[model samples]
Target: MSEFGQVLRGAFGPARVFEQRPLAPLTTFRVGGPADYLLETRSSDEIVDALELAGRHGVPVTLLGGGSNVLVSDAGVRGLVIRPRGGAIFELDEQHVRADAAVTINGLVRWTVLHGLGGLERWAGTPGTVGGATFGNAHFTGQLIGELVTGVHLVTRQGHECDVPVADMHFGYDRSRLQDTGEILLWATFRVERGDSDALRSTARASLAYRKRTQPLDLPSAGCVFRNPEPGRDVVPDGIPWSAGALIDRAGLKGTASGGARVSTVHGNFIVNEGGATAADIRALIDRCRSEVRRQFGVELREEIVCLGDAPVISRS
Candidate 1:
């Protein structure tokens, strides 16, 4: 073990921290290199402790949630990578539900539905965790997840834990204050209402069915590759649908390939790994998809996925 590894073990125990840990298995895409130091945090205390320790050591820190909407570079990540594994849920009252950041969206939805909690029942098939959804203000059926977030618990970049109400979140399409503040989400409390379990289950089933039909869930993918073009900012051409996938399809770019990566025929927006796909291949395909959309429709499709490792989280180029 290196000096830093020994220090990390002293603070967090040897089993809690890993060196050159392969990250591909941790992500939905099942592709990526390794993290120089990967710490599995089981509690908020561990999270802040690791952050403070790494900060003092001058090592960069990156937080990896339930890796759904991300593309990791083949070169791997530098410094410390923290993956919080805390999973706890609570019904604070008749109107609120608090979930640990690591709780999967599907798990939360199921838990709510079982308990007859209605507000989140409609989001049954959403990918990633509560933290990821809150971070990105995840959207579905014209609704943003942040709209239901009543409050959030996060550890700031300075390694201090704080709870902020929804009013301060600055939730917008594919964004939240966490994006700007660089805070690590630990838990989120959401608004809820009592409802019939049967009704909620019906809705949940419908959502799962819709995703199964429209999304390329069979292959390895990072979900939608690009955000749909915003109105006024990017005018949609006549006869073309306003969705990102539609634009890519209209551009005749579906099934487009770069190495093992290919734009899914089921959904033009998803780039799936057929087999032996590299992060570089996925990235090249993303670039091609954007260029083709721009050339054909004069609309530049923005990325919705996060890219990790020696690059900006979201690649504009």
Candidate 2:
């Protein structure tokens, strides 16, 4: 074993650390290269230890959750990739629930509904972990995940664990303070309301059905590709409104292809992998959408999907 491997084993034990782990399989998009070191952490202590070790070794660290909103580079990520496996959930009261960051958003939504809790049913079909959703302030329709969040438990880059309240999160469209801070979200507490279980379930079913009809769920995609442009912007072409999907569709980029990546015919905002897709291919498709949208509507669309490793190549003209 190499000296670094020996050090990792000593710090995290032999069972927790892996070498040269392929990252593609870890993501919903199923595209990425590999991580030089991958660490599976199930608790806050483990995560802090892994981060500390990475710092001591002068190696960068990347945090991966449910892997639904990210695109990993074809060249892979350097340093350690920490995948948190904690999935604990607790009911704090009749109107509150606490969930670990690693808990799936669907699982949390279902649990809340099963317990007759309201406020998260709109996210019934959402993919990815609570952490990923919270980081991006995931939204459906006009309801955002940040709205239900009361507080979050996070680990900072300096290895300090802290509790952050909702007001400090800076929640906005597809954004949160976590995006810039690189803090690891450990868990979150949400404020819910008691509702009729049957009614909540019905609402969840309706929302999920709408998603199924509108989204290309059968194919592999990292959810929406771009954030909708702000309303009333002059850059929005006349009659374009402010929908990202509508913008892409109007740009005539729907179903456009680059290698195995193609814009979804059902939802212009999604770029689906038609099997054998690479990160580069998806990047190319994203660039095409951005460039075409800018060309046709004079609006610069921003990406909602997060890219890891190498930065995306934006097209000019």
The TM-score values for the models, in the order shown, are: 0.96, 0.94
Q: Which candidate wins on lDDT? A: 1
Per-residue C-alpha lDDT of model 2 across residues 1-317, encoded as one tens digit per residue: 65666788898788988888899999989999888888888876888888888888888899898889999998788888889886888999988899998888989989999998998887889999998999999999888889899999999987999999889999987889999999989899999999999999999999999999999999889999899888664367677768889999998989899888899999999999999989988988888888888887789989899998754444222
User: What does candidate 2 score on TM?
Assistant: 0.94
How far does residue 199 in candidate 2 sit from its true spot (Å)?
Answer: 2.1
Candidate no. 1 TM-score: 0.96
lDDT per model vs. reference? 0.89, 0.88
Can you write out model 1's per-residue Cα lDDT over 1-317, one digit (the tens) per residue? 88998999998888889999989988888889899999988876788898899989999999888889989888789999989885888999999999988888999999999999999987988888887888889999799999999999988878888889889999988989988989998899989999999999999999889889899999999899899988877899999988999999988999988878899999999999998888888888898888989998899999999888994333323
Candidate 1's C-alpha lDDT? 0.89
